[model samples]
Target: MTSPGGAAGTRTDPTGTPHPDPTWGPLYRAGAWSALLFVLLVLVPVVLVVVAPLPPTRGAALLEYIAQHRVVYLTELVSFVGLAVPAMVVFAAVAVALKGVDQSIAAIGGLFGVASEVIALALGSSPQSLHGGLVVLSNAYRAADATDRPALASAAEALIAATNAVSWAGILTAAAILLLSLPMRRASFFGPVLSTLGVLAGAAGIVSEALRPVIGSGYMLYGLLLPIWFAIVGWKLLHVSTARAS
Candidate 1:
């Protein structure tokens, strides 16, 4: 990898594309702005879930608004438009300029991440398993204070756990594109690096309490660290795009 700056940073492939760009002024500017946009796209919900207190009144109503208002859909739509589309355009332009580069892998990583993330999110919501991990834990506590039987409670807890596990895996996959971008040593490196650590922590956490899952906090802890990473990544990528245009 090139040093942060200076002589060694000049290393480039045999064909002679400068590692830092002969004129990095524009590229660095682009990287900064792109990262900012990424941060905003990712931070809205995280702040709601984190810095802000749980609405306590979370219920079907919230879910209903999420659906009817189409908040998630709109948010995703904007990102797809203003963020992803722009990124692909830049990827193509850069690849053409480099001449010897293949754009396939980067494209695939982004596409696969979209697919896996969607699948994971869907699976987490599916009600197919009545006796899954999440339900089990919820019912367990309920049973302790109420009349629910062990079998029913156990089933629910398992479903809850399974969903939690699957969700984390999906998140890791969704973040895969960001993580894989690491090898590129792109202008936006902070987001992927931090997100990768979160993935590891999440996967390791689920593995830890597989047998006698207590009121767990492993996943909670892991989720806590992601918001900042998102902010920085979005901003960097947005800025990078702008820089390239200039």
Candidate 2:
């Protein structure tokens, strides 16, 4: 039997396994590159943190650290918040590629993914780290008088607390990954191993975000798994795009 693309030689075979329309080659290629970028963005902050551990979450200490390590702080901030950019692209491409497997699920997952990215971008922080307004607060704290410093410090602390607090953005992100993985498991293109990893990563991500206050460093489990999964997915997408092109 011929595939939906109306060509016997297209990626989809007689068994009815779904494949993306070859017309989506450009988007797939962009997504492939975005996936790699996402992985790099995830890794950079992790490595930076390991090399120069973040300051205590305390307002005064955090402010001082930001002042002293402005470069490092900004780099980490850019990496952390910038994640949404590539993530959005990857999610879009994945949604299009996987739509053939399950249209409704793919669309839902894509919306969740995009929503999470938007939230993260707006908030400018993640469950693991907080940076958004601290730099400006730090400068103000440094320039203020002794009495005024206290208020600025207090404000900074509030920002820190808010940033570290449990967030729906993280939860939605986990859900997106999980939802997308469901279709992936049934789709021949993604296969079982990748889908399994996605399921695990998504589940772990939700749990980590939910229990971050109690688990502390344990959140690293999800953090570590995420990049690994993205890296593999990115490589696969790259191959798919190349094959379609040729």
Candidate 3:
């Protein structure tokens, strides 16, 4: 049986094992607004651009730059910390909102979204791994004679390979957006046009990330599309009245 005043099949949680809660509707909308602000202010600008800057030079030169500019290193750590909490909340919020319409798709999409953030946070910071590797390599290269060149190069190559492995997180995030957008397309707030854009953004992200090796820095293209998609969704959520959500 359905909870009083709740639409049939609305569950209290994404797992759908418990009773439905009509009250969660407003909470999901509020979470959407919070996520929107995070995308606009933090994720797009600081996490993407600042934390992941273009390498001015490859090999020794790049290492040297990283060693000298400690701020870049520190910023990477800070970005991960700053992004972790909001990212989790936003994705969870998206999950809750999506569940209101399509529970199965929402559950899958939410997992993908969470995986994306978790991978980034898990690998992005650890001084002993990527961050520490950079500093250690830079310092070693600085002190090493010509005879040690080959060893340093090999180590750097290994580290770079490991770094690229994290790109799959982007693919997961794209999948989440694509799945979430499907239900939004049917919603009155998103409609066809904005929902179509959301679909396009997700598709672009998937393609860009998949072809990253071939296209080099082409994955950055999603940066342009995603903000717009996020803004549209966030705006709709922000303006949606509590009564409508309930």
Candidate 4:
């Protein structure tokens, strides 16, 4: 059958739906795998946190907790920070896939998604996690004299406060997802269900992040919805790739 673009050698599925352009095969595959990877990375820290709750936010308690639970602490750090890596790929792929529906919105969404990942990775810590700088301070706090201990502890507290403060990275991420969902609603491949989920997840993320200071732990809603959305998106993308391959 002829492609919509009247191109030669265009493959069609059993139901006569034309396969996506072969040029996009690699990107689809990459996005599929990365989306799954993002889910795994997110789950690791979440499970670890449930198994071993994070230490108190106080500088002294936090330092001691990290010292005692070094392995768990470090694992969480790796997982939370690593999320940005796969997320960037997924965002790029989704943007390209939906660009046909609305190029301007797609570009804006992709930009927000990319910028969020870059900012998060650059920060090297999330609101609930400690920065790498605090790890160094923890070691120093342990080794310092009594007088020095207070100063070091104070410094650690300052770092924690700064890291936990609300930032634009998360807001942009939510905006990206919300904007992308708008285009997805117009794309047959994504359809209404995925688009609806994206809208919920994005709205939840925005509300949770924005009100986190006032509504502690409410952000869990966004956290839970995000992985679910990613999982579905990943599976769908994989299906698309497999169809193309067949």
Overall lDDT per candidate, in order of appearance: 0.39, 0.83, 0.62, 0.81
The window of 10 residues in a row where model 1 has the poorest summed lDDT is: 93-102
- Cα lDDT of model 4 by residue, 153-236, tens digit: 888889888878786888888988989888787665788899999999999888887776667878878888899988888887
Off by over 4 Å in 1: 1-105, 124-162, 168-179, 186-215, 244-246
Each prediction's RMSD over C-alphas, in Å, is 10.4, 2.6, 5.9, 3.1
Query: TM-score of each candidate?
Result: 0.41, 0.93, 0.72, 0.90
- lDDT (10s digit) by residue, model 3, range 110-144: 88888887876766642112345666787888788
Q: How far off is residue 163 in model 2, in Å?
A: 0.3
Once all C-alphas are superposed, what RMSD does model 1 give against the true structure?
Answer: 10.4
Lowest lDDT block of 10, candidate 4 = 2-11
Candidate 1 clashes: the total is 43
Candidate 4, which segments miss by more than 4 Å at Cα?
1-20
lDDT-best of 2 and 3: 2
Best by lDDT: 2
State candidate 3's TM-score: 0.72
Instruction: Show where candidate 2 strays beyond 4 Å.
Output: 1-11
Which regions of candidate 3 fall more than 4 Å away from where they truly are? 1-22, 25-30, 33-37, 40-54, 76-85, 125-132, 143-150, 240-246
Which candidate leads in TM-score?
A: 2
The order by descending TM-score is 2, 4, 3, 1
Question: How well does model 1 score by local distance difference test?
Answer: 0.39
For residue 97, model 3's alpha carbon misses the true position, in angstroms, by: 1.3
lDDT of 2 at 228: 85
